[model samples]
Target: MLHIFCPHCGELRSEEEFHASGQAHIARPLDPAACSDEEWGTYMFYRDNPRGIHHELWDHVAGCRQYFNVTRNTVTYEILETYKIGEKPQVTADGKQTNAPSTVKGQGEKV
Candidate 1:
């Protein structure tokens, strides 16, 4: 099982309380109408399922219903951080944080 932090509620909850949405920090096309069909297709279908240090978007569906981001090691299932939506996670260059997201990977724990 995985733990997810809810930035709003400031609690670490079971992964069951949250749901993984997909890769995070994606920028929308500047001009959707001007994009070629292939470009649109790729944006709609292409996803990078990296094995390590992946950034993902998740929703607190059963808890606060707020969207947030997570940095986790897919291979180890270790959560590096969690942050509220609309902000970049304050990840250090070495992949550490002075204040990690308020949620936990398997349970909500205060940092």
Candidate 2:
């Protein structure tokens, strides 16, 4: 069983207690009407399935019932860090750690 940390609850809990929602930091289209059908469809349907490091949205269903972001390694199934919805992650996809928050928008951002 995997242990997942819920940033809201600040506790390590069982994987069964949580649910993986999807990819993190998805930005909603500013104007749905303005977007082409393909654009809207892409926004609603497309998601990344990377082989290595990934940022995902997860929910603490059995505990806090809040959404959080998780930086994990897909190959090893190792969770690098758990962060709150709006907080920046310490680890990046390139395997670098930084003390400062990332300026790149839509990366691990909440929809």
Candidate 3:
């Protein structure tokens, strides 16, 4: 079983204590009531299922009962990092720290 570190609880807990909610970073529509059925449906149901690094929202149901973000590998099922809702991940999809200098020159913007 994969041991997941809960950012809120500050302890490593078993995976059974949590539940994978879905794809993270889903932005709610600016005006939900103004959306058409098709638009609303797409916003509510559409999610990306990538083969590589995937960011997910998880709920610590059996622990602190708080929700957090998890960056994990889809194929290897490796939990890269867990963080609070408002915090940016230290690592990126290419397995590099966000603050690290890039190889390409003049492209130092956050992706």
Candidate-wise lDDT, in order:
0.74, 0.81, 0.79
lDDT of 3 by residue, 1-111 (tens): 788888888888888889999998899999999999999999999999989788889999998999988888888888878888877776677776688432211111111
For model 1, the stretches where C-alpha displacement exceeds 4 angstroms are 92-111
Query: TM per model?
Result: 0.80, 0.87, 0.84
User: Model 2, 1-111: lDDT tens per residue?
Assistant: 678877777677788888999999999998999999999999999999999889999998899899989898888888878888787888888878977965322222121
9-32 per-residue lDDT for model 1 (tens digits): 888788888888998888789999
Evaluate model 1: give its TM-score: 0.80
Q: Rank the candidates by TM-score, best first.
A: 2, 3, 1
Q: Pick the candidate with the highest lDDT.
A: 2
Ordered list by lDDT, greatest first: 2, 3, 1
Provide backbone clash counts, one per model. 4, 1, 0
